[model samples]
Target: MSESSIAIPTVYGLRSSGNCYKVQLLLDLLDRPYHWVDTDSSAGATRTPEFLALNPNGKVPLLVLDDERRLAESNAILCYLAEGSSYLPADDWDRARTLQWLFFEQYSHEPYIAVARFVRRWLPEGHERQAEIPRLLERGGNALDVMEDHLGSECYFSGGAFGVADIALYAYTHCAADGGFDLSRWPRVGAWLERVRAQPRFSPMAA
Candidate 1:
């Protein structure tokens, strides 16, 4: 924790989740102090009464302020934590552009890439869900291709600097191969990953 984060909020999240890791990454990038409470939505953890009270949606990456104010949704948390920081764009148009990419990540990217990783990591190979892997990979690859094209032109999703959009997309895109999506084909996207990793105080996803 940095001196800047001395009295910030508590973060309840699963260490392995990309959604949760995005918040963790932003907090680290901003040098914001936060208490990370390990909370797994899998293994029936998020469904528990205590966890449900925090987020009725029964999800991880929930943020609770010192005053007991709670906020859910991973991207929303990123926006909150990055406000007034370099991670968030000061101009209105650039900020909205950042949001545009964030929305693309959740809808067009994570649904395929992240879900494929979850199934592959947690489910048995012979399980019925394994049948979906091919389609997931196909969709995930398409999302990656889009990223490759965009990243080929702009150094970062924020246009000039690293910001929340880059973090949001980077979460799953970096671990894409875990879902069986071959990343070697997208050189531009791969380079962007390295750029984001090179940022100061950047932290890896917890093991």
Candidate 2:
């Protein structure tokens, strides 16, 4: 199909969400055209009946194809959009490595780091969630340590190349200070972030 005939995908997501920013970062890096529909998940927009009909999980960062088929989950959307691109490895072992890091980002990294950021940045001062920050910081620091160890030997997260897994982790890792993380503790990871930033067409997450 001609490029002009291809239908642009529409993304429904909150600009400030790390998960949503992952999708946007990958799209911009690939120079792919997409329409972004701002759906503020924090504002209860994702909970509306109309939004629920689109995704039963009631999450932002939903991807709607031209035919209206929808995809939920940030990493899933990344893998889908990265198919056949260098961003997704073609070699089985390399692709498996990429998937491994993607899993790690969601399971081992994001829950601690991203949630910490949310509680600290978005929650009202003295909100009960404030109580969770100490634990969150400790656990999130562990995740950063893991990334630091990995980066000590490797340059990128996706099987030795900058790819979707890097995008996945970078989404939250860059802004971890909002969660009270001291990036200086993870020097290699900090350097890796600079490399990710140097990639062509890189775009910073919205404020």
Q: Pick the candidate with the highest lDDT.
A: 2
Tens-place lDDT digits, model 2, residues 133-159: 999999899999999998888999899
**Largest TM-score belongs to which candidate?**
2
Q: What is the C-alpha lDDT of each candidate?
A: 0.89, 0.93
Residues 1-207 of candidate 1: C-alpha lDDT, one tens digit per residue: 233443678999998999999999998887878899998777888999999998999998899887677899999989888887888899988998999899999999999999999899988879999999999999999999898898877999974679999999999999988888888999999999999999999999987
TM-score of each: 0.95, 0.96
Worst 10 residues of 2 by lDDT: 1-10
lDDT (C-alpha) at residue 56 in model 1:
95
RMSD each, Å: 2.4, 1.6
